[model samples]
Target: MHAHTATRPVALVTGAGRTSNIAAATARTLAAHGWDVAFTYYRPYDARMPWGAEEGAARALHAAITEYGARALGVEADLADPQAPARLMDTVADRLGPATALVLAHCESVDSGLLDTTPESFDRHFAVNTRAAWLLIREYALRLKAPHGAGRIIALTSDHTAHNLPYGASKGALDRITLAAATELAHLGVSANALNPGPVDTGWMSAEHARQLRSATPLGRLGTPQDCAHLIEFLCSARGGWVNGQLITSNGGLA
Candidate 1:
């Protein structure tokens, strides 16, 4: 189940919904490092978020990945659909090969508080942020090629709460479900972990929010998509093979 023609390993990255999203950064980084990439995007979801909609974001990212000279495939699928993950894997295997790594960075959320949140909204959030993520990891583990330590899974999470109730709760579920992948897929040579990149300025953070975050963080800088891509690169690398099942907070010492 490796690359179709035995080329460099392929990485299937979710949440690469836009050109500037974290998944895009991770895909670009992996491509630069000689890994082929397959990205999934949910355009309707991104369109509803404050970041606004994107036209051909997936195609643009695919072009960028190929610029690194690595084969790239972009699929416009909604992970919330449940069946999307399997189709994504199949497409990758058929087009780019087996994915050596899976990065879940897609999220669905709004600033609805507990009192304001409707049942439909809450369920929609979980459908994408939690349920879809769980399914993707399970499929990734099952499709992984042999050699126990070759599979890598990284789930992105957030620590923010308050008005972000649905996001907070669903991501918490995402963290726990993904952590189990380490033990559940360990015998199969897969390592799974979660990363919380708090307060990334992905167009939602207002200027005031950025100032507050920078002032509070020891590094005095906002977390960037590159920051996330850098950490993910390590986890997928051989040196990070032993790191598993833990929720690592890579927020530049946000205190």
Candidate 2:
């Protein structure tokens, strides 16, 4: 049953497991701008992190989207699986129609240096952050039914590689994959770009760490999920279609 009659564009945002995260913010912002939003989350990943899973966050996000007069679907997806990307794309298409915007905010980030990083951990990071992104983009481009120049792909990336080798390396690969979509998917008129939103504390930072970062940033505060969400809202808009194929840093000039 197709719920989309093209009355509003659809957006597929991954990693929206937590209501306070960037992906959740992006989903709500897009919905407010007349988009039907479908988001994926893996609670197991959040459970493994220092910030344990937020129970019922996805339900709350769906309710929020509906409050904005937009349809919403939440799926529990483990992007580490090679098959998950295609399944995700298909599920979103079946429910809300083909997504015009694909926001990849999912990641496998476990802090380990070159010596401490295990082979299994490295492989998992690449599987989730790099290969999954590539596969998702491929699925999206192939299944795209949106009109020409209407497709958008936005990937969130980071450059923190000192103590976090595998995560950063895989993200570097993701950046390349996203940028390649800009040229390769040109035939389909899909504009792709990577965005680095530096140090937005979504409950992972110590108070001291947050204060240090706040003082370091030229803007005298940490970046917020809304900061990234607003920029992504623009990137997914028709007006932002021209600003493609670039790696944009939306950090508040942290030095």
Candidate 3:
């Protein structure tokens, strides 16, 4: 906790525990750009994924963010909890002033199709992917003291409905929910957009899958966390202020 004075700009990022993740990369990019950062993560969720959870992803991310000489804080939180989003905002404000931007990179990714969809699974995905995002965007707008157009809310999305029903459907909801936030919050200096980064290898791809993904993209490679982070940087910048209520695709022609 650096206890920064002078009202340093801050960004609150969720799912930014793993160093190999987009959340971590975005946090790093934000830090490098003179923004103090706070992040939240839930390891239990990550543990359920094929790519097992990293033991101290929060600690490692904190270290990396602070290395840029910016204050950093990481909270182990389950966004699926309705109360968690508000608590996260309060914690971030208490530690690092009000945030000017929010980047949501957390998701519940279970591989199940139409037949795989269950009450529990669908609800869990909605809890994290859709509900949490809605709350976070709302809270960010309400918490901000900045003038209209200073608030930035960006969420990561995917279109994997065929193979991953719950995950894809929930993210689809996230896209609309965040866009609605953009439309409603535009008067408050808040710009919201969804970035759909298709098929990135964040340790979630097999060698053959990675090769297939690379072959599918015209760039002949899969996306990187940093690639998404760079777009985030722009969206949070003055130049990207006009880009609002749009679902910008950052895929290297992997559609």
Candidate 4:
């Protein structure tokens, strides 16, 4: 492994779609903690995917990270493509040396319920959520192996996994996939873990929906991107090194 100067670390975060997006918040949080960030976004042709607004969001995040005095690269990629993860990683490495931290937060097709879910939908989710994570970890391990200072991989899961929705099931699969990788990579100085969040107020959820979720949550409030980002920032730090192979739920104390 090529050694990097110990002064500041570099991180790559995928799926940072909007400034209010959880992944974008996590990137800013990490930057505040002194890590340079490289982030990715997906642009879909569909009118529902909010692809057109991502460039503006990326610009805002770039400003936030820079305000923290860290370098930031905001890349637009289509994670639905099987080869996109490797290409995204290459872009990140080209912009900011080898990464010490990686965050897989890309998600697609949340509209697929059990009755409407198709094989194609399942495969798409698996490819973008689980398989992409696998490819990223594989590449990360190949590059940084043991003797490196506790490389970290953090995957964003969903509370729906526990509720067993079709989309949730996909996230559950992602959690399991991450755990398997963590078990194998822990001995090699890398740690992998998943973070699950409940209903978050990301402006995508309607006000009525957010209010209903807040009523259901024990904390009497809906989660915010910043709430999730705080925990992710901790996970990427030295303070969170011992937290490995676990699916941590940050749902305002909700089960």
Candidate 5:
């Protein structure tokens, strides 16, 4: 039941939904770099808000990655659950062996304004965006202490955190957690970091929002999933060994 053949390295990516999302791009990028990929998708019953109609998008992403001759497994889990991270790690270990790299890409909130955000919204964001990420990193660190070389843990954050957005504040907390975990895990051969993508052209942004963001960016264009994916790929590679406890922003100087 090993997810990949004994030869390939394993990578786990969370929040890999269908819509050309950052997680999807990261998965493909990792596969291209020769790592078997396993990603998580929230079940339809568990989706709290309308995530658009990208049916079977996760499956398509899995197929695309596997097409590159690497193994891909998609698991459906409720990230809001406190135990989800442990369960996810267990699933990955059972199906794909010990993961050498972990990507925490799951997010559950999209509230635009602070006034409109609810307590439930805050809790959900913290649970999925911050807490689960911490748990994943902890589990990965515990498993990597043996003589298998150092592992990588990359979590996604947002420029909104710098802009004082409520959801972004939660991400800020997640960033702090990453820093603390990185210091603790460094001794165990695990490097933890956060990737903050400024504005991406995901369908999540409205036309007006997209225009404003693009105009504000010095690059005159919004970020793309591939942009984030490339950085993630580099960080997960041997070359990124020295990068730990850093918050690398991938924005086009929009901040």
Candidate 6:
């Protein structure tokens, strides 16, 4: 953690364990735009994924954020634990300050559908994707200190439920919970919205799959972490306050 800059607002971005992902990109973008960043990541979850955890990713990301002259803290948190959300908020407050912006880019996705989707996997997805999101929002709302129209909350969502049942269903629930905050927290001048950035490679797509996706999209290219980060930066700014209670898609017109 670096010196607290009262002039710059603090943003807590979840799921930024790796330097290659959207959350890491968002942290860098926010720091460059005059916002201190505190991000959370669960190494155990990433280790289990097809793309194994990148060693020392959190420390590397912290250094990357500070390069832009902003304070940064990378916390290792398992959002699956029901108690983690409040603890994360307290930790951020102790280190940086109360976060004015909350961006949930974390998820528990294992790509099992229908019969293959076990009950434990379903429960885990809801616990992290849906329940943790609600808890984090609650914590943010309780501890927020931003001025009118300065509080912002953004959740990354998806509409793909066919072969990715649990993950998609949980994200669907996340969307509703996030949108509910937009109206419920209106008195605090907070705006909540869900963004669906379709088909970001992020080491998830194979060479063939990436080519196929690129060919199907009108833009003739794939979405990158920076593409999503730019929109997140916009939503956290004063200009994006009015885009409340909506689900915005930034997919480069994918077919």
TM-score of each: 0.95, 0.97, 0.95, 0.90, 0.90, 0.97
Please identify model 4 stretches exceeding 4 Å from their true place. Answer: 1-5, 45-47, 50-55, 145-147, 161-166
Please list the Cα RMSD from the true structure of every candidate, rounded to 1 decimal place. Answer: 2.4, 2.5, 2.6, 3.1, 3.3, 2.4
> What TM-score would you give candidate 2 relative to the actual structure?
0.97
Question: Candidate 5 — which residues are off by over 4 angstroms?
Answer: 1-6, 45-53, 145-149, 161-165
Q: Per-residue lDDT for 1-255 in model 2, tens only?
A: 112234888999999989999999999999998899999999999999999999999999999999988999999999989999999999999999889999999999999998999999999999999999999999999999888888999999998899999999999999999999999999999999999999997888999999999999999999999999999999998879998899999899999
List, residue by residue over 183-247, the lDDT tens digit for candidate 4: 88766777789988777787777778777887888889889989988888888777787898899
- Tens digit of lDDT per residue, candidate 6, span 50-165? 89999999999999899999999999999999999999999999999999999999999999889899999999999999999999999999999988789999999999899999
For candidate 2, the C-alpha RMSD (Å) to the true structure equals 2.5
Q: List pairs with backbone clashes in candidate 6.
A: none
Better of 1 and 4 by lDDT: 1
Candidate 6: segments with Cα more than 4 A from true spot: 1-6
lDDT of 3: 0.87
Off by over 4 Å in 3: 1-7
Give the clash total for candidate 1.
1
TM-score of 4: 0.90
lDDT, candidates in the order shown: 0.86, 0.93, 0.87, 0.77, 0.80, 0.94
Q: Residue 115 CA error for candidate 5 (Å)?
A: 3.2
Model 3 lDDT tens row, 159-249: 8899899999999999999889887886787899999988877898889999988988999999999999999988987678889999988
Q: What overall lDDT, based on C-alpha atoms, would model 6 receive against the true structure?
A: 0.94
**Candidate 6 Cα RMSD after full superposition onto the native fold (Å):** 2.4
